[model samples]
Target: MPRPLDRCHQHLLAALVVRLPPSLAALFFAALFLAFPALASAHEVGLSRGDFVVEGASVNGEITFAQRELATFLPGLDRDRDDTLSEKELTDAHDRIERAVIDRIQVLGDGSACPGRLLFALPVEGDGVTLKATFSCSAPPGEVRFEVGLIEDLAFNHRQLLRVGGGPRVSEALLYRKRKTLTAPIAAAVVARPSAPAASASLPSAPTPAPEESAPSTALDLFLMGIEHILLGIDHLVFLFGLVLLGGRLRAILLVVTAFTVAHSITLALATLGIWTPSPRLIEPAIALSIAYVGVENLYIKDAEGRWRITLPFGLIHGFGFAGALQEIGLPRAEVPKALLCFNLGVEAGQLAVLAVWLPLLAFARRRGWLTPRVVRLTSVLIVLAGVAWFVERVFGA
Candidate 1:
């Protein structure tokens, strides 16, 4: 087994890899050139930011958010169908956009409703489409609660980082789908009343438990986000399917899966930690490339022998792909490590769930002699076709 495998690797290296079937190569190369533009964009994280100042019943703020995100809520804004919200398009739809923005985010002053109004909308660089707005309440708030409705409509993994300034130190929170409200306690100095100093001691104690509660909630939400991301990632799933579809010894599948997990985990941690990050444009096309590579590779190898080597490099790319999806590039440093850890864990759990169902079914088919070379060939061809289509879409669509 070892000798034959070694010879196969030698042959692969010598020929610079055997020529792919001519038909497959022709279609892939043709589409690749046509979709070359898509390599310009990478997967971005689902993140946004808002800075608010509270002063005596009035809260005014500016939020920098992903245009694509807002597009999810108001897709019609993409008028050109380019998957982007352009400046002209946004400016043209100013009234509708403004109303939509201010209406979705609510500000509550000391539990009293604060009416919100959009002041302006500006399209910024990258995915940032900025909105400046104000909210008015009956009285100055001792505590300000910001409720973001964006999360409910955006992707499950979306998080909005909020800065509420009425305190000695600005209070911030990362709000997700499950945790949409951020209650920022206004410092006594900012929202002053003469008796605040005397009552401050007790007031501080009341909100002290918040940090404790936040950690768990944040972790759980991120974990679920990771799961949703993996499950919804058609590209990632297709690649995974290519890896294990050949159904072989359980041990071999485990090894291949482990290799992929470790590689992606390393990159995921590194990218999330800001240690090393890859370009967004490079990631999506490369991911498509990985799927194509695997589909072609599976056409030759019947078993999982030496498959880890192939999965390893691509796994690293996959990690960047995962992080790229997070575009959490602007997320708080303090929360990143926790989010990375929990999200990675959730991804692994989701990966296992998928394998648990598929592997056994494949094993059952193998035992029944239902697994045949013809089926594998057809599946591989289909994977190759899908990879080509995705590569073109990501490039041209970007």
Candidate 2:
């Protein structure tokens, strides 16, 4: 018989031979998952076009926000230990929040971007707090589409839901223009537009009354949202990818995905609907750590059955991270069921989309006999790298 070292070397050689096919497939998937962030960076939420034109008249609009708890925002400066803020504290707090908000804003059209002046004078006062803002954008002469979203990170003690309502009113207007003829003759012609310019109308103003803080929305929505969140969410997606690499049958993959889905959905519903809540400071770190766990596990484990047993439990912690968005969005009062259903449905849609696009490619590669043990080993290493990246970023807040 050969010596122990020789046997080990032989095994290493075998492993090396198996690596290429899976490595290629795994690398391809990694590139696919990365496309999301690239796309997201391009279509960021915010108002881009400076001025919208409505048939020669420029359009103008403004927005304002007020927040309470002006004092607790600063720590060291709160010398009195009183909950209310002093002048020094107020200025400091506002300055910090304002800067945070401004930094998130991206100006569109014009190359130059600058923080607009804060119109602190439009003071709207609420219980123990007062604030206001006024901004205007003009539209040049012509018909155009206008788009805007709340991109500012406004400060508040609790998260608030913002409601956006607007619809265009279809109306017709006649205009004459000089038409070019085939004979090169300039003739005045009147054209009747088929689609009327339905001006998008928005309500003037409304008070944001304190919310009743109802229970969470429908179970379906909560569940679906959890699915969607996991799919698009890069951290969770990376973890799922590791789970996928274990080379399980369709049933096996479903079992693992179902386990993760059920676990996270449970916590997501509970937390978002107000039954239970986890601190962001804690949840964020754990989420990162979960990625590392999956990565490290991939490096050691080669069997499918063993991995599912581990995936089920780790998936529970991931649910809390999914609940983060719903917590912020809050369940809609009148349409709680609808809100929950839609949100969850959106999540499921996203998850299915990812699976639909990637799974077939995976199947094809497997059919080609690409998922050999060597490929698995290389894939595991890549997962480990991704998980380490996530862990470091989260733990250090990088």
Candidate 3:
């Protein structure tokens, strides 16, 4: 028969591997709330006359995805399984789903002008995992327009442009007339251009006009955006939680947080500044594995042994992940340093904030001897289990 200690370890591990106790759940939810930040309005929708610019006439619209449909697609993603989507899951799922959006958008006239053959792939605002494109006749300038809603069969409408996945669906199939635009002088001029006598039209004009270029995204915004991103990032928070669980004293927690802060900041700067770059596909799974590693280390090691050893090294990897958030926002060269500093600062602020709340509690627990060998062992085992769960999910999620 297994020894009592062995049985205890196994049982605790099992619990953590599957799910945490209700008590831990409260802490986890609290951490989730503080860590990931979001605004009621998450996505930006508008038009730009000058290559991704904010034209005089800009329209901001929001898209909502069906929570029930996404739950069916990625089961684990449904955090509550309540047939509803929470903010965090919606944010986490943004990248994968946003890729399917159709960028085949065309702007017909100049500033304050009508648009022609407009096509856009818009993300479902709440769902985070769904996308849809609206293909409609060009609207003249100064027309009030609404989010055309999800288009079910973009393939039939713009078969040439619809290359990948099917976009989101509208509740019902309805054909609404496109908005009519009050053409600008430039538009009227183009329209009046004698249609180049049918005979002269023989020489096909440039097959398709060059697409308007994507506008530049700022580094400051990107950096702050990174802060906003990490705050909303679930996997990243999971990794930080593992770190907090290990450091039981205020001093130790400070040392660990500092070491992590310094180390990750270096790497984040290097990667974001283009001094270095790593594939996210590789970094993401590895990040999940890193969480598992610490959890496993916590289970067996019992305490941090030395200064600037494990924490700093692991912190370096975490910094890379932080840099990835910067990458997602696309920082500009002129703003590289500022973006790097602010982003790293935001990351450190987050780590410091977590330490502030957790360290004191841990210290009190230790002083009271509540962090007994049994409890420490249990905490370690549970952490390892959570790490393992993340590892499996990330690996298989591919």
On TM-score, the leading prediction is 1
Tens-place lDDT per residue, model 1, 354-381, is 9999898888877887666766776687
Give the TM-score of each candidate: 0.72, 0.52, 0.51
lDDT of 2: 0.43
| lDDT tens digits, residue span 310-397, model 2 | 7777767776665554443333334344444555566556666777776787678778987666666666666665555555544553
Indicate the residue-level lDDT of 336 in model 2.
Answer: 42
Candidate 3 residue pairs that clash: 36-231, 36-232, 63-125, 140-181
TM-score, model 2 to reference: 0.52
How would you encode candidate 3's per-residue C-alpha lDDT over 1-398 as one tens digit per residue?
A: 11234888768756664686565555444443432222101111111101121122322112223343334434575666544565466556554334322222332323332232212222232222223222222332332222221233221221011111111111111111232121112121122111212122122221112223221223243334445555555656656666776564456656776787788788877877778767655665566677668767777654554534787887788677666533433333543565566556665665566657767887788788766665566555555555555555445543
- Report model 3's TM-score to 2 decimal places: 0.51
Order by TM-score, highest first: 1, 2, 3
**Model 1 stretches astray by more than 4 angstroms:** 1-64, 71-96, 118-133, 152-214
| Full-model lDDT for every candidate | 0.70, 0.43, 0.44
